[model samples]
Target: MNTKKEKPLHSLFAGATAGAIEAFVTYPTEFVKTRSQFEGKRESPIAIIKDTLKTKGVKGLYSGCTALMAGNSLKAGVRFVSYDHFKGMLADSQGKVSTPRSLLAGLGAGMMEAIFAVTPSETIKTKLIDDAKRPNPQYRGLIHGSVQIVKQEGLKGIYRGLFPVMMRQGANSAVRFTTYVTLKQAIQTRMRTGQNMPTSVTFGIGAVAGLVTVYTTMPLDVIKTRMQSLTARQQYRNSFHCTYRIFTEEGILRFWTGTTPRLVRLMLSGGIVFTVYENIIAVIGARSPDK
Candidate 1:
């Protein structure tokens, strides 16, 4: 376990930087994934990408990217800072948190981010993406679109799918942090590296954690996306209704509609996020006066 204390501000900065970079680099895959989820029938990532390119050009693949990028940065910053805070409180006298406590901390962090960052941003992103698919797009841009949503629907509009988002995010962080930490510790112990494990190894472990998280939480993700879509109020009454409709109308397989692109993006996201976060933390530590 890493015993060195990390300042919350440092965690925030590193996490935000990591998230922004990851979002920007992996946004095309995310676009494809969301589009696939909206499809009546399952669509391959390649097919979606080709269609998007043909219809909307390369820029089409990046629709709603601004909302997502900003939200991702904020969500990551809050997630890491809150995770560290919770973990610190749960740590033993020796400054180590057990697996269960770490998972709890991650859960707290995920819920915190969901409330403050993820839900609103995700709702906006989903709306923008959905709008862009229309014959006549409604949103002009990020700022304008956001204002329009607020004006038309109020705060509730931008905070659609709060319940599912919270559930998904909480489970997501719990699984991801626990899995990543456990795998990383096991690898480090086997390699006798303590906290000096290679970047490649860290990245590999993080990627595996992402894979685990995706499979476990895919249904929640689909539900969250649907609830946040433009026609959410018209199509579904609540999360439970949305879940039932999807299961009965679409089938259980519908829950995993965008698994391919999500898997790819998250695998890359996990690796990039952890590697960048750790490196930045290391740099910050090295420069600390107390170090």
Candidate 2:
């Protein structure tokens, strides 16, 4: 009869675990998503997939599943923890929740999440995705790719697109969470007394937020992809050198090449990711045999 227990903690841990598992399960699609965004004149996603399947089969899709799991575990864990902590911080500072405070919650959560988890994850994730469709194709699998990148480029190599990921993902978290909170409150108030916002609305809001973010950050993403994946880790010798070359040579437009696919991926990915995470949290709380 000992029901006085920690349900939110379980939900939090479950959400993190689920998110990490989902990252790996969807690794291939994510790999495709990233590659689809990084293509240029002669590079097409279909061509990349066909070539990859022809050359590698299932391995192509699951290329970065391991790195993805690690990335997502940390990424999701930090996100959930930060959102909770940030919300608490805001509540304490401002005395109560308001629309502006909700938005601030999103902004702070996104910034901190990126600072904590984007670099190493993006480096490994991008490299794995890139190697799958690389012109010369240097890696055999995620393991080999990761090992080679580290050995040749040192520990720094694994964080190639750190800044861009931080920018894009940070903005993404802020926008997505803000949209979610705003929509949730709007829904709550609009309904007469007992009604709550429907799940579909939450998803829609998340999609909108994701769309806004991806479009804004698409250019930076393309550059980051090229810099992280296509470029040699050892060649740049440092992140700054690689970034400088991309900026000076590729021009600005080149930075936005794979924008369309990225938008699509973000919309779908963001909606599902937030929706799933939220639902899973709810389920854990409800099902835990505790008050």
> Which candidate tops lDDT?
1
lDDT of each: 0.90, 0.65
lDDT of 2 by residue, 47-140 (tens): 7668778887977677777777877777776776676666666674335566566566666766666666666767777877766665677877
Give the local distance difference test score of model 2.
0.65
Q: How far is 23's C-alpha from truth in model 2 (Å)?
A: 2.8
Candidate 2 local lDDT, residue 243: 57
Top of the candidates by TM-score: 1
lDDT of 1 by residue, 59-130 (tens): 999999999999999999999999988988898999899998989999999999999999999999999988
Candidate 2 global TM-score = 0.78
Could you tell me the C-alpha RMSD of candidate 2 in Å?
Answer: 5.0
Quote model 1's TM-score: 0.95
